[model samples]
Target: MGFKFDWFMKGMLGAVLLAFLWPEPGAKGGFLQPELLNKLGVALVFFLNGLALSLASMKDGALRWRVHLLVQCSTFLLFPLLGVALLWGSAGWMAAPLQIGFFYLCALPSTVSSSVALTIAARGNVAAAVFNATLSSLIGVLLTPLWMAWVLHQSGGNFAVGPVIVDLLLWVVLPLVLGQFSRPLLKDWASRHKGLLQKVDRITILLLVYTSFADTVKEGVWSRYNPLLLLQTVAGCALLFLLVLALTQWGARLLGMPRGDRIASVFCGSKKTLASGVPMAHLIFGANPAIGLILLPIMIYHPLQLLAGGMLAQRWSSAEAAPS
Candidate 1:
């Protein structure tokens, strides 16, 4: 089979280019009213997420404590510690906004969709993947903010936690709860239109990316940085993915986990959600043009994980099919 390029990824890159060439529509105070759309997109994504969640599957996956613990720790702890170490080591060398982006990338939750999709392709414990990915996103609402607050403080920037938390609860948590409650009435319909719902999620993310880069470009945020710096940041994002992936694999092996559980842990633990990251950045940074700059690391990291995870899943799938 021929390799297929990810359409959503291509769309994202195009969105960035569009922002560069013609950012007028998406920028703040522009004709599109992207700010209003962004807010709606955030709420819509979470509501769809809540509506799609499977309570029974979640219960079943919850029994695997070891797998869950490893995924959560690698996501929230191992990655963040690595970010801090990198920041400390690169103190004199790297740019500040990019530094914050890198750390924020580290603290993000496991991606809900891609993580589960890759796990299933790899013949992993699907239930556990679903549970862990969902759990990570929920917990990230709280943890990501806390981590960003510290990063902002360290960089001498301000973070009003009270307002940010209120916004998150209002836009993120509240919509999610409503969606989950609506599931009793909407689950069958949601399940039937899964493909459409997934598209909605992807489109919202693309919209967020477009508006953010538009704001950044309009404010001349990229003028201060060079293309070479971006190349380096891409390298940094790739390295971070590799390091966490290796750690998760090693931890799974040391615990003598079954192959299925190990695949679940490795994939789920290594992913950082660009979907959640972008919306949260908007809430946290407001209209600061640097919000786009702060999103660079995860934007770079997302595709890297998808490419690598796809290859790994194919290999694992073939291995599982082989005769002993």
Candidate 2:
């Protein structure tokens, strides 16, 4: 989550930059274009994930049901509720797609790696962090699409829940299930090639970003958005993050969670996963001209959460180290 670039993130930025500058590669083309690659990449990414997951570790973490419930509720339920309220109030200021996009950001799952990493840095419950983070992603595989379908349907859009669910099961869920079932045969090999598989996850997300942005660019998405809307998106996301962080902290204390559990709750519950968000956007918003606008809040929220979480983790860690 630091400012330093991982080669994967760099590739992500490069893909977006390339798409922005010259979108012809990712632009609408025949069957062999970037769009088709995105579909295959999505399947491949989830399948590899199925191989790489440690079911035993996930099971071990599952025993902490209360903590897990809190984190997932905060991630899936509370965030979206708050986002709805904000989007409702901001409709005048924010455009239609962007307003809903902000709400979409709230419904994303917690980051798998960074949530645990930040929890460890803050002296939080790392095992619970891992458990909740993993569980959040798995849940999001279904929940995110359902949430999007509901939200869009409520807004009277053409997004059909049946189709959305079918697509998710086919592209995301099926591959994951296949990978899980195939784990016995491939687990050892997956562990050996873990680093390489993670790169696949990064690449899948990048390709989705490239193609989505390229489509939006062709539709003149950037032309509609201005400097003020961009700034507003940042401010709104920061405020939303603060609100979630504060509420989770209060909720933890009310539930009599320990300091470690409280720390995990705050970090895991308050943060959203960009890695998952970008790809899911493609699945949900498929070929929408305003896809770029829908991603604005999410793109802004990613870095904001990192910087905010980094500072908060350092301060909390320092406080924990001090004698009371």
Candidate 3:
């Protein structure tokens, strides 16, 4: 337990340090060019996603359908609505760019690798985790843009959903679909090379984070958002995380879900996917590179969520082992 906590904390600290230390010469060029390093990181992330998914053991009969339904509601319908409401309420006060960032974060999908890892650590239903993660990614491609359009429209921004959808289909959905289709040929190889792939996943995420933060720094986004606003964003994200975590857990219990399914629902439903969000942000809001600053909430919250969720899972697993 101590080892796991130590490792997680160290990895997070490393990521944060890397974000600050990574050079930002590209940002000075006045264009958000896709550096070869960043593109390679994105591709590696997708490849590992495909590999991790292939190793997942999903049993159709194992899950409680009602629990899955509850998860979907929390992830797809409930969270997006909350995000729209928050943005609408703050529209009069928030800067236009930050408003877009808030909306974009809300529309993003749930995390995949971390979700399953936490679920497995907690002794939850891994298969359900995979299913929910994959399904959320698929649905998010469409839902994110739609929800963003609605939010932006309400906020009086001129956002065209059609172009967003086209971009999503081209960049996010198609890569995922191709990865899924290639799973048969890659799964065995991935299994054999799990260690190497794991390293690749870690490196890719680190590069993505560095590039993203570099963009924010380059765009003068940090200066635009003061300390107070940064704190507010963090508070808002914490509230959002707590709300979803509680709601998902309560819904799971209310539906009489088993322990494993409940764990899966809570972890999978409560989190957002950075892997998907970073790429989608580049595709959808590339015109404004500063839009990546909006993802800060998720980026900040992701590690916190994982640390908290992991500890909770560890506790639950220990309790389950105690004899009656």
Candidate 4:
């Protein structure tokens, strides 16, 4: 409960190291270069996501408009703003790659599993957590790209808007909608196999990581980063997370959301998902070696959020009654 190993996270760590050493397995024209395999994996991630969603839960959760709006805005709006502020504050400190990566981190969606788990631990609105977290992933498929594209365009970085939207719709939304449409047929099977299915999602993410890093390592990208820079990146991720966590808590209370919903806002709004991030990055950036660097902040943030959120949940749960 305190610090858990997200298999996908561990896989991503392994992937970077492996890419650094060999770079063949995950590289283009290699056995694991992705190609059609990557598309299938991403599609499967969202398909399973759709299968796991409960329409009734989403409906009920949506009715809490204030809570829902707060969480979504905190995630999509506030997080990006904080990232920009951090970029400004660290102007001389952070490199361009790190800055871009950090900005991407801000644009990511909340983690569905960890957010909901922490919400339950904190005695928050778990149903709302589920609804909002799931909704965030769906929203992220569209929003993250738009933000990234606009930012990159403003900065004169390369961005292909048309292809990005096409890829997202094909790999993310399309599969998701298909799964939702077929949920009535697969609901019982999905429910029973939830544990296994979740593993599948992790494995798919791991595959994406391998391909992403493989692409990067081939370019000798790791040569640029030293231990000091790595440590600073971690520090940057921690600072961004802590600041957003504090802000979400304050905003939730100010919005007059109830205690249960506030916990969900704080937990879900504060998290960024490696599961969704890695694959989406690969999809968006396509094996750019800098992706390993791009994913760096998120890789560090994943565990920090888990550990920090767990500690906060333990404290928050004691203050409120567990939901029915």
Per-residue alpha-carbon lDDT of model 2 for 1-324, expressed as tens digits? 344446765776787788789877776782338667867877887787677666677665666666887899999999999987986788677888788788889888888877888898899888888889988989998888778778787777887777767778888898989999999998888889888778777877877788877887877877876668878888898899999989999988888888888888888998898877876777788768788778878887877777888888888999999998
Question: What lDDT does model 1 reach?
Answer: 0.89
Candidate order, TM-score descending: 1, 4, 2, 3
For candidate 2, the per-residue lDDT at 271 reads 86
Lowest lDDT sum, 10 consecutive residues, model 2, at 1-10
lDDT of 1 by residue, 83-180 (tens): 99988978977878888889999989999888899989999999999999989998999999999888778878887889999989998999999998
What's the candidate order when arranged by decreasing lDDT? 1, 4, 2, 3
Model 2, TM vs. native: 0.93
Clash pairs (backbone) in predicted model 4 = 216-289
Q: Residue-wise lDDT of candidate 4 within 151-215, one digit each (tens)?
A: 77876888988988899889888898998998999999888988999888888877777777777
User: What residue runs in model 1 are displaced by over 4 Å at the alpha carbon?
Assistant: 1-4
TM-score of each: 0.96, 0.93, 0.84, 0.94
TM-score of 1: 0.96
| Residue pairs in candidate 3 whose N, alpha carbon or C atoms collide under 3 angstroms | 110-273, 111-273
Clashes of each: 0, 0, 2, 1
Would you list the C-alpha lDDT of every candidate in the order shown? Answer: 0.89, 0.81, 0.70, 0.83
Worst 10 residues of 3 by lDDT: 1-10
For model 3 the TM-score comes to 0.84
Tens digit of per-residue lDDT, candidate 3, span 98-161: 6566657667778877788888888888788888877777678788877777776776767778
